[model samples]
Target: MEPGAETLYAYANRRRREITEGVNGGSGRIVPVTIAAGTFPFPIDATTRNAIASAATATTLAGGDAYTVPSWLLPTGRFITLDATAIVVVALAISVAFQAVFSAQAAAFAGIADGSVTTHEAVDAILGS
Candidate 1:
């Protein structure tokens, strides 16, 4: 038996409403996708898709904290490479300063115990050292 016109039209309208509601209600939800690093490999029309793809890489897009594209994929205007050497140098400097401070404190305490320096003098030396 054939379906009636009213039943068919109602079914189509219900399906349309279901699709529209699903799209609107799920806004701001995280959807997972994968893309390689360093290339605008995704279609331009879908921003969400591109963002998800870009976030898979360590290098973030320039002008924004959020990774919008792989560093390689971005135009020179759109992205900047992180300074790994600068980071390493700063880390080393911090480590050396910490070591120096601790060594000075230990030496000052030792000197105070050996009677080579007074307690008050040791405290001042530790602070300056």
Candidate 2:
């Protein structure tokens, strides 16, 4: 996991570069794909295909808190809250901070706020082969 915001920023930038600007002098090539989802025919465009492929790695980063990013991003301790209602609020804030920071970096890399990389279920749905 990334030890801090700087490392996380670097990793996301690297991932974006690898996908968008590879060795071929900037003119990106389309990968041929055939998708059969069900009785209905599914034809995925290049942007969608790229997003779907990237989602595999992206979702892992998305679930940063569950995957233990809080260890690196936040202070170590059990979250304490006297108010019962505020307990969920406090916990969600800490976890969501870890998630939102990483995901926001991804959005900036892609030049849009369209990352569908939220959970493992999302990746499975988008990238199941």
Q: What would the per-residue lDDT of candidate 2 be over residues 38-108, giving only the tens digit for each residue?
A: 11111132343343334433434555323221221111223221222222233333334334434645454
lDDT of each: 0.36, 0.33
Per-residue lDDT over 57-77 for candidate 1, one digit per residue giving the tens place of the 0 to 100 score: 322233334323224222224
- Estimate candidate 1's alpha-carbon lDDT, on a 0 to 1 scale: 0.36
Residue 71 lDDT in model 1? 44
What would the TM-score be for candidate 2 when compared with the true structure?
0.24
Name the top lDDT candidate: 1
All candidates: CA RMSD (Å): 28.6, 21.3
- Residue 51, model 1, lDDT: 43
Worst 10 residues of 2 by lDDT: 67-76
In model 2, the clashing pairs are none
